[model samples]
Target chain A: MLIKKGAEANLYLKEWHGRKVILKHRIPKKYRLKIIDEQIRQYRTLHEPQLMHKAKQAGVPTPTIFMVDTANTTIIMEYIEGKQVKLILNELTKKERISLCKKIGRLIGKLHRNGIIHGDLTTSNMILTPTGKIFFLDFGLGEFSKELEAMGVDLHLMKRALQSTHFKFADECFKAVLNGYMETFGQETEKVLEKIREIERRGRYIAERKEKP
Target chain B: MEYCLGIESTADDFSVGIASFEGEILANIIDAFISETGGIHPREAAQHHSQVAGKVLAEAFKKAKIKPKEIKVVAFSQGPGLGPCLRTGATVARALASYLGVPLVGVNHCVAHIEIGKLITGAKDPVTLYVSGGNTIVSAFDAGRYRVFGETLDIAVGNCLDVFARTAGLRQREGMPFGAIIEKLAEKGSRFVPLPYSVKGMDLSFSGLLTAAIELLKREEYSLEDIAFSLQETVFAMLTEVTERALAHTEKKEVLLTGGVAANKRLQEMLRRIAEEHNARFCVVPKQYALDNGAMIAWTGVLAYKHGQTVPIERSFVKLRWRLDEVDVPWVKE
Candidate 1:
C-alpha cells in the first residue's frame, strides 16, 4: 500500500524477506522532459543510499537500506515504526522537548562533521522510536559537502522549519540545539553559526535595502 | 458604482487602470519604456514614467468614459521594485487622492500579481508560483498572510533568461520578449548541454547556470539552439520542482501561475502537469493580466479598500523592497 506521496517520490509499505520495509520509488515527473526526469531520479536514487550509510557511520541513527533497485529508481529500507518528531514535539514536556531537540542537534552535528549536509532538516523528517531513540529519515536532498556555506544553509533550513512549524518554542529549542551542536561539532560550530547569521543577513539585506530612504 | 484608479510605475511600464468596486476592470492603458541598448536604468525609467504619466491617466479616463470625480479611491503599486520608479507612481497616486478627496490604498506588487490571478482565474485558494524579471517566488496563504515557501537565492529566473538571450545576440522585439525568442529556439534544439543546477532546499540559485550557459556560448562548442534548449529545460525544471514542493507542503487544491513569466507556454505546460499529478486545479492568468499592469493593482486596491485598509497621504511612502509576506491580506479567509 502507498503510505505517503511526496513531490519527487512515493513511499510504499511492503514485506521484504518477511520483514516490513518501505519502498521509496522516485516517480518520473511528467512535467519534466523524459531525459531530465530520468537523470534526476536515477542520480538521487543512487546518491541517497550512499549518504544514508555515511550518515550511519558518523554515529547518527538511520534506517538500514535493505535493497536498491536503481533500474526502477527504488530503494527498500527498514521501516521505522515511530511517531514523527513534528507530530510529537508539541505533546512532549518542556524537559523532554529540550532533550529531544538537543539529541537532534547532536545528530545533525555529527552529520555535518562527516561532510554530509541534510538539505532538508525539518522535524517531519525525523522519527522518535518507542525506546527513546531519534532516527533521521529522508536523505533525498542530502549532499556530501565540507563547505561552510553548505553547512550553514543546512542549519538555516532547520531554523526556518522550526520557526514555521514550532513557532511557540522555536527560540528555546534552537538554542538548545545549538548548545548540543557546539558540544559535538567542537570549535567549527562557531564558524558554522556565523555563516548562518551571514546567510540570514543576506536574505534580510534584499528586503531591508529599501529602508535607506 | 464606485471606482478606483491605479497607477503602475514599478518598472519599465507606466500604466493606468480603472476598475469598479464590484471587481470589473473598465480600462487599462500602458505605456512602456523599451531600452534599445541594454537593460532598464532606474532613473531613466522613472523619468519616462513622469513624462508619460499625464497622457496615460488621460487615456485611462477616456477609455473608461468616467470622469476623475467618479473615482472614490486612488491606488498605486507600492513596491518591491525600483526606487525611483516607485516614487514616481506614488507621487501621482498621492496627488490624485488628495485632489479628489478619496482614500489612498498602497498595494504590494507581488501580492497584486497573486490577487489579480486569483480574481480572474477564480481560484479560491492556491499555492502561487509568481515568476517575473524582478521576482521568482512560491507562496501560499497561511496564518493570516501569504507565506513565501521558496524564492530565488540570487537572481530571478526571468532575469537569468533575459541575460542569456542578450548575450546570445538576441534582440527584443516589440511583442516578443527574450524569453519567447529563447523558447522558440529551444523547440528546435536537439542536443542538451549540462549546466549548473542549484536547489538549496526550497530556494534556488540561477546565477551559476546563467554564467555556465554564457561561457558555453562563448566557447561555441554547442549550437545556440541546443544551449537555449538546455537552459530552458534545466531552469524550468528547477522552477517546477520548487513549485511542486510547495504544493506538497501546503496541499492547496489549486496552483496559480502569475507574473510576466506566466506567458511562457513551456512554464504553463510544466505547471499544469505537476498540478494534475497532485490532483489540483491549475490556472494561469491570461496574457493581459499576467504581465505587470495597473489592473492588478486596481483590483487589489478594491480588495483592500473594502476591508478598510487605506493609507494616509502623509505616510503614503513607497516601499522599494516590500516583501509579499510582509503585507497583511485581510480580505482572504482560510
Candidate 2:
C-alpha cells in the first residue's frame, strides 16, 4: 500500500522476505527530460543508503537498509513503527519536549561530527518509537560535507523547520537543542552557531542596515 | 467609483495601470526599455521611464476613460528593484498624487506580484512561488504574514538563464526573450549534460550552475540544444523541488506560480504536477500579470488604501531592498 507520495519519491509499506519494509521509489518526473530525471533518481537512490549507513556508524539511529534496487530507483528499508516527531511534538509534556529536542540536537551533532549533513532536518523526518528511541529517516537530501558553512546551513534549516511548524515552542525547543549540540559538538559549537547567525543575515530581505528617515 | 493610478518602473518596464476600488483593472499600458547589447542598464532604463512617463500615463488615462481628477490615489512600486528605476517611478507617483491632491501609496514589488496573482486566480491563501530576473521566493501565509519558505541564495533562476543565453550568443527576437529562445531550443535537444544541481535544503544556489553552463558553452563539447535542455531540466527541477518542499511544509490547499518566469510552460507543468501530487489547486498568473506591470501595483495599492495604508510625501522614499514579508498585507485575512 502506498503510504505517502512525496515530491521526489513515493513510500510504500511492503513485506520483503517475511520482513516488514518500506519501499521507497523515487518517481520519475514526467515534466523533466528523460536523461535528467534518470540521472537524478539514480544518483540520489544510490547516495541515500550510503549516508544512512554513515549516520548509523556515527551513533545516530537510522533505519537499516534491507535492499537496494537501482534499476527501479527504489530502496527497501526496515519499516519503523512509530509516530513522526512532528505529529507528537505539541502533545508531549514540556519537560519531555525539551529532552526530546536535546536528544535530537545531540543526534544532529553526531552526524555533523562524522561530516554528515542532514540537509532536511525537520521533525517530520524523525520517528519516535514506542520503545522511546528516536530514529532519523530520509537521507535523500543528506550529503557528506565537513564545511562549517554546510553544517551551519543544516542547523539553520532545522531552526527554520521548527519556527515554521512548531512556532509556539520553537524558541524553547531550539535553546535546548543548542545546549545539547554544545555538549556533544564541543569546541566547534560556537563557530557553527556564529555561522548560523551569518547565514540568517545572508538570507534575502533580512534587513540589517538602518533605514534612513 | 474611486480609482487608483499606479506607476511601475521597477526594472526594464515602465507601465501605468488604473484600477477601480472594487478591484477591477481598467487599463494597463507598458513601455519596456529593451537593451540591444546586454542586461538592463539601470540608469538607461530609468531615463527611458522618465522620458516615456507622461505618454504612458496619458495612454492609461485615455484607456481607462478617466480624467486625472477622478483618480483617488496614486501608487508606485517602491522597492526591491533597481534604484534608478524605482526613483523614476516614485517621482512620477509623487507628482501625480500632489497634483491630484490625493493620498499616495508605496507598494512592495514582490508583494504586489503575489496579491495580483491571488486576485486574478482566486487562490485563497496559496503557497506562492515567485520567480523572475530579480527574485526566486517560495512563500506562504503563516501567523498573519507571508513567510518565505525558500529562496535563492545566489543569482535568480531567470538571471541564470539570461546570462547563459547571452554567453551562448542566443539572439533575442521581438516578443521572444532569451529564456523563450532557450526553451525553444530545448525542445529539439535529446542529450543531457550533467551540471551542478545545488539545493541546500529549501534554498538554491544558481551562480554555480550558471558558471558551469557558460563553461560548457565555451568547451564546445555539447550542442547548444543539448545544453539548453540540460539547463532547463536542472533549473526547473530544482525550482519544482523547492516548491514541493514548501507545499509539504505548509500544507496549503493551493499553489500559485507568479513573477516573470511564471510564463514558462515547462515550469507550469512541473508545478502543476507537484500540486496534483499534493492534492492542491494549481494556479499560474496570466502572462500579462506574471511579468512586472502597473496593474499589480495598482491592485495592491487599492488593497492598501482600503486598509488606510498610505505614505506621506516625506516618507514615500523608495525602498530598493523591500522584502515581501516586511510589508504588512492588511487585506489578506488568513
Candidate 3:
C-alpha cells in the first residue's frame, strides 16, 4: 500500500522476509535531466542507508535497512510504527515535552559528535516509538560534515523548527535540548552553540544591511 | 467609503495607488526606472523616483477621480528595500499626508505583498511564498502576525536569475524583466545542465547556484538555453520544496504566490502542483498586482487604517529592514 508521497521519495508499505517494511523510492523528477536525476537518486539511496547505520552506531535509533535496490533507487527498511513527534508534541504534558526535547538534544549531540549532519532537522523527521525511544528518520539530506559551521546550521535548523511549529514552548524546549547537548558534549558544544549565535548574528546583519535604503 | 493613498518607492518603481477601505482599487500608477545595464544603481533609481513622483501622483489622482484633499490617509512602504529609494517615497508620502491633514501608515513591503495578494485572490490565511529581486520568504499568518517560516539565506532567487541573465547576454523581453528573458528561452530547451541545488532545511541559498551557472557560461559546456532551463528548474525546485515543507508544517488551506518572480510560468506550475498535492487551493494575484505596484500598498493601507495601525509623522520614517513577522497584523485573526 502506498503510504506517503514526499517531494524526493515515495513511502510504501511492503513485506520483506516476513517482516513489515517501508520501501522508500526516490522518485525521478520530470523536470531534471534523466541522467542527472538517476545519478542523484542513486547517490542519495546509497548514502541514506549508510547514514542510518552510522546514526544507529552513534546511539540513536534508526530503521534497520533490510535491503537496498540501487538499480531502482529503493530502500526496503524495517517499518517503524510510531507517531511523528510534531503531531503529538503539543499533546504531551509540559514535563514530557521537555523530556522529549532532552532526548532530541542528546540524539543530535550524538550525531554531531560523530560528525554527521542531519540536513533536514525538523520535528517531523523524528518518530516516537511505543517504548518512548526517539528514532531519527529521513537522512536523505544527511552528510558527513565535521565542520562546526555545518553543525551550527543543524542546531540552528532544529531551533528554528521548534520556533516555527512549537512556538508556545520553543524557548523552554530549545533550552532543554541545549541542556542535553551541553551535557553530552560539555565544553565542545559551546563553540557549536556560539556558531549558531554567529549564524543568527549574520542573518541579522544581512537583514539590517538590506533594510538600508 | 474612506479612501487611502499608498506610495510605493521600495526599489526602481515609483507608484501611487488609491483604494477604498473595502479593497476596491481606484488607481494604480507606476513609473519604473529600467536599468539599461545589468543591475539597479540606488542613487540613480532614487533620482528617477523623485523626477517621476509628481507626474505619477497626478496620473493617479486623475485616474481615481479624486483630489489629494479627498484622501483620508497616506501610506508609504516603510521598508525591506533600498534606502534612497525608500526615502524618496517616504518624503513624498509624509509631505502629502501633512498637506492633506491625514493619518499616515508605514507599511512593510513584504507584508503588503501578502496582504494585497490575499485581497486580490481571496485566499484567506494562505502560506505565502514571497519571491522577488529582493526577497525569498515563505510565511503564514499565525498568532496575530505573519510569521516567516523560511527565507533565502543569501541572494534572492530573482537576483540570481537576473545576474545569470546579464552574464549570459540575455535581453529583456517586452514587459518582462531580464529573468523573464531567461525563462522565455528556457521554454524551448530540453536539456538540463546540472546546477547546484542548495536547500538548507527550510531555507535556501542561491549564490552557489548563481556562481555555478555563470561558470558554466564561461566554460562553454552547455547551450545557453539548456543552462537557462536548468537554472530555472533547479531554483524553482528549491523554492517549491521549501514552500511544500512550510505548507506541511502550517497545514494551511491556501497557498498564495506574490512578488515579481511569481510571474514565471514554470514557477507557477511547480507551486500549483505542490499545492494540489497537498489539497490546498492555489492563488496567484493578477500580473499587475503581482509585480510591485501601488495597488497592494493602497489596499494594505486600507486594512491597517481600519485597525488604527497608522503611524505618526515623527516616527513614520522608513524601516529598511522591517521584518514581515515583526508587524502586528491586528486586522487578521488567530
Candidate 4:
C-alpha cells in the first residue's frame, strides 16, 4: 500500500521475506540534472540505513533495517506498528506527556552522545507503539556530526517543533526533555545545553539587529 | 466608505496607495530607484524617496480622486526595512495624518506582504513563503500572529541570485532585473555545476551557495549558464524543502507565495508541486502585487484600521528591526 509520496521519496507498506516491512524509495526528480539526481538518491539511500543502525546501537529506539537496494534507492525496514506521537501528544495527560518527553530526551541524548544528528527532529518523526516503546523514523536527513553547532541546531529544531505544534505544553515538554538529557549524559550535557541557549540568543539577535533603528 | 492612504518607502521603491475599507485598491503609484550599478545603496535610495515623495503622493491622490481631508486613516511601512527610507515614509505619513486630521497607523512591511497576498489571492490562513530581496521566511498563522517556522540564516534568496548575477556579468535586460536575466539564461542550461547546499535543520543558508557559485564563475571550469542553473536548482530546492516542511508541520490547507521573489516561475512551479503533493491549494499573488507595491500596504492598512489599530504620532517612530512575530494581529483570531 502506498503510504505517502513525499517530495524526495515515496513510502510504501509491504511484506518482505514473509514479514511486514516499510519501503522507502527515493523518487527521481525530473527537473534535476539526471546524473546528479541519481548520485544523490544512491548516496542517501545507502547512508540512511547506516544511520538507523547506528542510532539503534546507541540506545535510540529505531526501526530495524531489513534490506537495502542502492541501485533502486530503496530500503525495506521493520514495520513499526504505532501512532505518530504528533497526533497523540495532545491526548496524553500532562504527566504522560512529560514522561514521554523524558524518554525522547534520553533517546536524543544517546544520539548526540554517539555524534548523530537527526536533521529533522519533530514529534511527527517518531512513533510510539502500543507497548509504549518509541521508535524514531526517517533517517534520510540524518548525519554523523559531533560539532557543538550541529548538536545545538538539532535541539533547536526540536524546541521549535514543540513550540509550533504543542504550544500549550512546550515549556513543560522541553523541560522534561532537558531533565532526561541531564540525567543520562550529565558529563558533557551542560555544554551542549548551554550551546542551545547560545544558539537561541544568536537567532534572536539576528532577528532584531541593534543597528536597525 | 472610508479610505486609507498608505505610504511605502522600505527599500528602493517609494509608493503611495489609496484603498477603500472593502479591500478595493483605488490607486497605487510607485517610483523605484534602479541603481545604475548592482545592489541598492541605502543613502541614495533614501535620497531618491525624499525627492519623489511629494510627486508620488500627489499622483496617488489624483488617481484615487480623493481629497486628502477625506481620507480616514494614513499608514506607513514602519520597520523591518532600511532605516532612512522607513523614516522618510513615516515622516510623510505622520504629516499627512496630522494635516488631514486622520488616524496614523504603523504597518509591518513583512506582514503587509502576507496580508496583501491574502487579500488579493483570497488565501485564508495560508502557509506563507515570503521570499524577497531582504527577507526569506516560511511562516504560518498560529496563535494570533504569523509564526515563522523556517528562514534564511545568512542572506535572502533574491540577494543571493542578484549577487551571483552581478559576478557573472549578467546585466538587466530592457526592464527585467539581474535575477530575471539569470533565470532566462538558466532556461537554456542543461548542465548542473555542483554547488554547496546548506540547509541547517529547517533554516537554509544561501551564503555558502552564493560563495561557491561565484568561485565556480571565477574558475571558468563550467559555463556561466550552467552555474546559474545550479544556483537556482540548489537554492530553490532548499527553499522548497523548508516550505514543504512548514506546510506539513502546520497542516495548513493553503500555500501562499508573496514578496518580490515570488515572481520567479521556477519557484512558483516548485512550490505548486509541493502543495499539490500535500493536498494543499497553492496560490501566488498576482505579478503586480508580487513585487514591492503600495497597494499591499494600502489594503493592509485598511485591515489594521478596522481592527482599531493605529500608531500615535509620538510612537510612530520607524523600527528597522521588527520581526513579523512581534506584531499583534488582532485581526486574526486563533
Q: How accurate is candidate 3 locally (lDDT)?
A: 0.87
Q: Which segments of candidate 1 are over 4 A away from where they belong?
A: A90-99, A163-176, A201-205, A208-213
Question: lDDT per residue, candidate 4, A61-99, as tens digits?
Answer: 899898899999999999999999999998999999999
List where candidate 3 sits over 4 angstroms from the true fold. A29-37, A201-213, B170-174
TM-score (second chain) of model 3: 0.98
TM-score of chain A of each: 0.94, 0.95, 0.92, 0.91
Please give the C-alpha DockQ score of model 4. 0.34
Best by TM-score: 1
User: Per-model C-alpha lDDT, please?
Assistant: 0.89, 0.88, 0.87, 0.85
Worst 10 residues of 3 chain A by lDDT: A204-213
lDDT at A94 for candidate 4?
93
DockQ of 3: 0.37
lDDT of 4 at B2: 87
DockQ (Cα-based) for each candidate:
0.52, 0.42, 0.37, 0.34
Candidate 4 Cα deviation (angstroms), residue B121 = 2.3
lDDT of 4 by residue, B1-334 (tens): 7898989999989999899998899998989888645788888999999999999999998999988877998999997888888898889999889998899988989899999888889998899999888899988988888887887766888889999888777666336887688788888887877777677657877887899899999998888888888888888887887888788667789999988788888888988988887899999998678777788788889889889898889999898778887777889867
Question: Which digits, one per residue and each the tens of the lDDT, describe model 3 over residues B145-264?
Answer: 888888887788888999999888766644778877888889987887778778888888898899999999999978888889889888998898789878877788899999989999
Give the TM-score of each candidate.
0.95, 0.91, 0.92, 0.92
Q: Quote model 2's iRMS.
A: 2.3
